[model samples]
Target: MTCAFILGAAVWPGGRPSPTLERRSLHAAQMYHAGRVSRIMCCGGLGRNAPSEADVMVEILTGAGVPRTAILIEDRSTTTRENIAFGLERLGMSDEIVLVTDGYHAPRARAIARSLGIRCTSDSPAHKARPRTILRESGAWLKFLWQRMRGI
Candidate 1:
């Protein structure tokens, strides 16, 4: 019973899932419907002036025909590290996990999980995003690489 881990993005002020989040959530839902995974784990935390990202993702997945019981939310991780760490713990460090996120974010997401000693597979929906998203993710990659260089 592999669980699909849907990494959350920002939520709009009105609690809408951000584009990245919606994309990932939809992908997770599709995987569930296709019998690729047994459950979906939505991961994210609250941001300023917005609801928890995980909550938004759970809502989106549920609305996309995924049953509520099939979705689990970890709404307390504001950063990728927190998300991976807390999610791994909540899921009992299961080896059967498929990390879902945008392409640009998958490397770092997978690295973080591996750093924590959790082995799992990954799946990123086709990458199409605003220029801002590309830039932000690029910076994230640099930061992750720099931290690794520094052994942080």
Candidate 2:
């Protein structure tokens, strides 16, 4: 069964889902309902706030009408690479999967998943990102490419 892995984003201090996270989790729910994936794995570790990003994602997915039984949480990862590594381990299967994140972030996430020998696809909610987010993701993508070039 294909699993959709929702990458982490910030959570409000009061455990509210950040806009990016909400979009990704909602997309995950839509994908699930459409039968694109059999399960959803929410991936992220705790931020400065109490609840982990995965926790916020789970709440959002369930609130969006995804069954709790179909959701899994990997709350031990803080970065995209860690998210893929730890999330794949938690899943315990190399079956087909999808990585859900912002458009700019998907390349790095996909590269990391591919490096781990995962058969994966990426999906974004197709929202325009803020200038700051684009800039940050650009730098991240460059780093990913450099690492790959260096065979790291």
| Per-model CA lDDT versus the true structure | 0.85, 0.90
Q: Please, what are the lDDT tens digits per residue for candidate 1 over residues 105-126?
A: 8888898888877787889888
Every model's Cα RMSD, please? Answer: 1.6, 1.5
Q: Once superposed on the true structure, which residue ranges of model 1 sit more than 4 Å away at CA? A: 129-131
Q: Residues 1-152, candidate 2: write the lDDT tens digits.
A: 89999999998888888889899999999999999999999999998886999999988888989999999999999889888888889888856789999888888788888877776899998788799998998898888889889988
Error of 2 at 90 (Å): 0.9
User: Pairing residues by index, what is the TM-score of model 1?
Assistant: 0.91
Model 2 quality (TM-score): 0.92
Q: lDDT score, residue 38, model 2?
A: 90
Task: Supply candidate 2's per-residue lDDT for 4.
Answer: 93
Worst 10 residues of 2 by lDDT: 111-120
